[model samples]
Target: MIRMFIRDEAGFVVSAELVLIATILILGLIVGLSSIQHAIVSELNDIGVATGNSNQSYWYTGFSSEKDFANGGFSAYTRGSAGNDTQDDCDNDQCDISCDVPVNEGPKSL
Candidate 1:
């Protein structure tokens, strides 16, 4: 019986068909999974590229705008007085009387 079973070629075609079907399924699965992975990687790369582009294109000259608050000759300016008065009393007498008097000093140093 064992020898007859070993020598039988009845299920040879069925085994070949099963192997062919499994190989085709495995190849299809590998191709489909690789395509999905490629697509995901491409999308992530695009997102990264977009981020980099936006960052690079961003321009900020300064935090605030340049404003000139200069007063172009129209500011609140007032003219000074005329001059000086040459007729003033100095101490208890006239300004030119004892104006050149020197103070009392100690001994002079060598």
Candidate 2:
């Protein structure tokens, strides 16, 4: 039985074909995933830009009123202000996929 199995080549071709097909599928999957990652990063960058561009500043005028009633007087006051400047740290910059490391020279002798 061992000798017969060793000489058996019936499934050899099928195994080789499976390996080739699996390799191709894995390569394709890697390429597809890389593309998806890029697309998602770009979209997120766009969203960040949009959010940064939006201004949340607001202002409302203040009011003061005084009413006198038979015995006492009532007074009301309100203050308004504006804030929230549109300052985006990204500055509408797109997402960079590459690593940008600064090269340092070797240590200098004292």
Candidate 3:
């Protein structure tokens, strides 16, 4: 008489199949997450480029929107007045000043 043996009849094959499916699922999840990360990075890079272009255009053309022009003027005046008033007050008793300072009064024209 001859005896026949059953292959993976103890649920081992089923468990191996489950493990393989789980591994594939995990790998898919990893790839999905990486794609999402890449998309976010790409979007951020695009936004950065757009903002840089806007700033460059503003500076290059010496053209600013109303809000930007107002803010720039305020900042320029504030910066010009910042140390001068304090120095003048310390040097003398009164805050004597002049408005002859031109906007963008630097070595290079902007």
Candidate 4:
């Protein structure tokens, strides 16, 4: 019985198959998660752009009214200034260093 148990190969193939399936699953999960990360970043950047493009300027005119023999009421005008959105200097497309040299190039006389 001991020898037969030791020689049994029936479960060996199942174990190998399980390992292969798990490896494949893990690899696919990694790829899927990377894609999700990229999509989320893209969406967030779009939201930032949309927010930057929104206009908040507004204005309202004054009003006044008079009665038979008296001054009734009056309101002053109001306005808000608006400005164009400037390009971000540190945006993703321009944030990377253009040169191959390291930022902290060790002392020249090292």
Give a tens-digit lDDT track for model 3, residues 1-110: 13335433454455788999999999999999999999997796667555544422211223333446644543222111121122222232233334785677568775
Question: How many residue pairs clash (N, CA or C atoms closer than 3 angstroms) in each of the candidate models, in the order given?
Answer: 0, 0, 0, 0
Question: Per-residue alpha-carbon lDDT of model 1 for 1-65, expressed as tens digits?
Answer: 99998899876465788999999999999999999999997796667555544422232232333
Pairwise lDDT winner, candidates 1 and 3: 1
User: Which candidate tops TM-score?
Assistant: 2
Measured by lDDT, the strongest candidate is 2
Clashing pairs in 2: none
lDDT of 3: 0.54
* Per-residue lDDT of model 2, residues 12-63, tens digit only: 4657889999999999999999999999988988887788677778777887
Error of 2 at 84 (Å): 4.5
Report the number of backbone clashes for model 1. Answer: 0
Cα RMSD, model 1: 38.9
User: Which regions of candidate 1 deviate over 4 angstroms?
Assistant: 1-14, 56-110
Better of 2 and 3 by lDDT: 2
Residue-level lDDT of model 4, residues 1-110, one tens digit each, is: 99999888775455788999999999999999999999998897777666655654555454444343355443443444555555566543444445676687577783
How displaced is residue 17 in candidate 1, in Å? 0.8
> Which of the predicted structures, 1 or 4, would earn the higher TM-score when compared with the native?
4
What TM-score does candidate 1 get on C-alpha atoms? Answer: 0.38
